[model samples]
Target: MGGIVPMRDAGRTGTLPATSDELSRLLTVVRRGRVLTVTGRFREPRSRLVREIARRLSSNFCDGAAVVAIGRPFGVRELTAALGCVPGMPFLPYGTADAVSWLAERDMLLVLDGAEHLAPEALAWLRRLLTAAPGLRILASGRSPLAFEGERVHRL
Candidate 1:
């Protein structure tokens, strides 16, 4: 699938093209055997959206791949559980390097949510994860790019 595009509000006239097709194509490529990072502002009540994408990823990639969300106060445990993966502790305490290494080894999705505050750290983690885990893909939700090399960013 392509990157997740935010639905346009009714009657909105001007905005960036949603590039849903491109995002899907990229997703397909990544699903085959690559890493992807999705960065943008995610809307609240994200369960349904998360579940749908996770379901597709699970179906296509098997259970090895997981969507790991990093942020505060978002009920990530429940969300990951709903997606049928054991929810690990939030990527705090452990430094960015350690967190990335741990998650990469697991071959999980590694979703980084509400990461504006942790952008620098998250970028470092993403770079390491991309290098360390060939099977891992990241779907980050934030207000800006991680600015890593080869990062295919799709804005929301």
Candidate 2:
């Protein structure tokens, strides 16, 4: 069920209106940092903001920007699938190391949405993903920050 969603610029329609000041701040964060975590309370529009920022900054990444829904317990299979990698033989499950190796050389922006309940295993894998993929930038939207070593957090 997991698939990569292309980053779409919300443009002038179908988007929550954001203050120019807030937009500017987020844009700066996306451009200047490798990891950004957008934090807000329940029912907030953090995902919208994350998507908008990803759209605006897509050009900076050579492999383009993609969104991966992280609302449930996610792991390497889900990540690999979202990145358009098919799950191989059922007896040989895709592992985190494989996902990391697959993504290691790509310069891309990954938007992770609804990560409030992300499992510890998934979070650990994310840490490894960031470590292995030097050209990768992650923009996450959740109720709490992912707390990666170099993560930049913006609270709404």
Candidate 3:
């Protein structure tokens, strides 16, 4: 489920191993409409590895998947923009349950990144999303489990 894909370093002139075969396998699972959750430390300042992984997944799922990256320092705008997010401010209102519910109905893959930093709120949101959106599949990357029933975990 994993292969060494070429990734670029920001300040260097070489490639590195950025993602695991496990990530590839997980992407496949997402393609097949299964929820894929990942737990680990995420360092930003986009590396070639991250870009490559995103590229592969985007190519495969395209309109059928969407990624939700939640973290402190909230660089979500940057990442989502990079992923070609359509221009709209859905997360502008804090704790808006209605907005969250609306987002959950889209037939897209969800990527919940950096949930470790916002465990309580993020987990609650995930739980609600899971319950509200039957067609939604989640791919979460955090340091711990959201602990919702039926979640499949992959550790890195």
Candidate 4:
């Protein structure tokens, strides 16, 4: 709760607290779905909300997590390590297939920040990951939708 930083929208005439009860309710909705994408024109503020949600979920037995930025490909290995998984268990996965397999059966929260710039194809792994790991939940933020089937898109 404390880690969340409110956003200043200079684009508008007034600034608003980016993190609000509305965002909390949004998190509740996101929690209900296996996959969720938070979209907004204000990328920074939206991403801040996503990060806050992830922070709230971090202590809920999350095994892996990352705020994947634009221009960055898959970095699930670093997330896995952040979750306390041993580094280089066998090999680092650079692709989604291997990343999914690497995260098989793990109950984790993976955050994808700046998702709008991410190629839609890059998220093909989400469907499989959701199906394979029942305990996994993805929280993404971007201007556009991830377009994954069953993905709940919340726009701010």
Q: Give the winner by lDDT.
A: 2
Question: What's the TM for model 1?
Answer: 0.53
TM-score of each: 0.53, 0.82, 0.58, 0.69
Candidate 1 root-mean-square deviation in Å: 8.5
Better of 2 and 4 by TM-score: 2
Go through the candidates in order and give the C-alpha RMSD of each one to the true structure: 8.5, 4.3, 7.5, 6.9
Poorly placed runs, candidate 4 (over 4 Å): 1-19, 71-91, 94-96
Stronger candidate by lDDT (1 vs 2): 2
Distance from true position, residue 56, model 2, in Å?
0.6
What's the distance in Å from true for residue 71, model 2? 2.9
> Candidate 2, which ten residues in sequence have the lowest lDDT sum?
85-94
* Span of ten consecutive residues with least summed lDDT in model 3: 1-10
lDDT-superior candidate, 1 or 3: 3
Query: Per-residue lDDT of 1-156 in model 3, one digit per residue for the tens?
Result: 111122222124345343566557655666674455565554342232333344467545433434444445333333333234432323323343654566555555555555455435545655666678666666655666657677777654
Candidate achieving the largest TM-score: 2
Higher-ranked by TM-score: 2 or 3: 2
Query: Which pairs clash in model 1?
Result: 1-24, 2-23, 2-24, 3-23, 66-109, 68-110, 68-111
Residue 36 miss distance in model 4 (angstroms): 1.6
Q: Count the backbone clashes (under 3 Å) in each candidate.
A: 7, 0, 3, 0
lDDT of 1 by residue, 1-156 (tens): 112222221123333233567546655745654434445555432322333344446545332334444444333233333233333334332344454455555555545444444534445545666788666665544566656675655555
Q: Candidate 3: list runs displaced more than 4 Å.
A: 1-23, 41-54, 59-65, 73-95
lDDT of each: 0.46, 0.73, 0.49, 0.60
